[model samples]
Target: MYFLSKELYFPPVDEASFEGVLAIGGDLSIDRLLLAYRNGIFPWFDEDDPILWWSPPERMVVVPSIYKVSKSMRNLLNQNKFSVTFNQNFREVILGCQQIERPGQNGTWLSDDFVASYTKLHEMGIAKSVEVWQNDELVGGLYGIDLGHIFCGESMFSKVPNASKIAFVTLIKYLKEHNYKLLDCQVHNDHLEKLGAIEISRETFMKVLKSEEINFSSSIQQHGR
Candidate 1:
């Protein structure tokens, strides 16, 4: 595996290991983070390990036009039991993601430094959150890096049944309406697969990531407008 230094550089994704670990030991500076995401790379490591960058051979992505919502989810949306908002409370959304326990994970990868760094990204308007509120309480939410046309989702948490799903569906609808190219879930999971996310070769994903057709102006419309 390659090791990163002070230089804001990363090895090509094609050079990654079989497990997709591209490089290790890079600071999550704003510039580095931005550069990483723009190139279809992301950092994921446990709290005790050095920052590890990855560019998987296959990317799990949801094309906005093709995202699927189940009949049950459609009924839930029709009921309007939850309200969704964007960028209203990013810190809390990320904190929720950090604290929520997952089935196979021993602990979260979202350490304090990771939280603070991504929070700074949110302040700078590059990171965004989708909050699901029920009776005005923060029941569920998700957060990710928004790179104009592609949304690189990091994590999500749900305090109640289906809350995170609601947040996700709402975000997909918004993206579809606004013409987003892809929702980069980054990796495959059964949950995402159920919601129409599919695996594509890194080459296919990189094409969309590096596409010049993206309308940067589309990113300016924020807060669920």
Candidate 2:
């Protein structure tokens, strides 16, 4: 693996190890984060480890036009039981993601420093959160990097049944309406697969990023318009 520095660069994704670890030790500066996303690389390390960068051999992605919502999910949507909003309470959303436990994981990767850095990105309008509220309580949410056309999802959490799913489904509808090119889930899981996210070759993912299909005007509409 490669080591990073203050210079703000990561080696090509093609040079990554067989396990897809590309580099290590890079600070999560805004510039580095932008550069990393542009190159199809992202940071994913345990709180105890130095920042590790990766470009997976196969990328997990969701296309808004093709995303699937189950019959039960559709029924839930029709019930209008939850309210969804964007950027309404970003800090709370991310905090939920950091604290909510998941199976097969010992601890959260969202350390305090990671939260601070990502909150900065949110302030700069490059990161986004989807909040799901029920009876005036924040029940579920998700947050991610918005590289214009592609939203690189970081994490999501649900405190109630289908709360996180509600938040995600809302986001998917918005993206589909607004013509977002892709939702970059970064990695795959059975949960995402159930929602119609699929694995594509890294080369395909990189090509989509290079297309720059999302831009400022496209993003502004997402800000409560």
Give candidate 2's total backbone clashes: 1
lDDT of each residue in 67-97, candidate 1, tens digit only:
6688999999999999999999999999999
Global fold similarity of model 2 (TM-score): 0.91
Please report the candidate that would top TM-score against the real structure: 1
Off by over 4 Å in 2: 212-225
Tens digit of per-residue lDDT, candidate 2, span 136-206: 99999999998777889999999998999998888888888887888888887899888767777676677
Question: Candidate 1: which pairs clash?
Answer: none
Report the alpha-carbon TM-score of model 1 versus the true structure.
0.92
Runs in model 1 deviating more than 4 A are 212-225
lDDT of 1 at 171: 91
Cα lDDT of model 2 overall?
Answer: 0.86
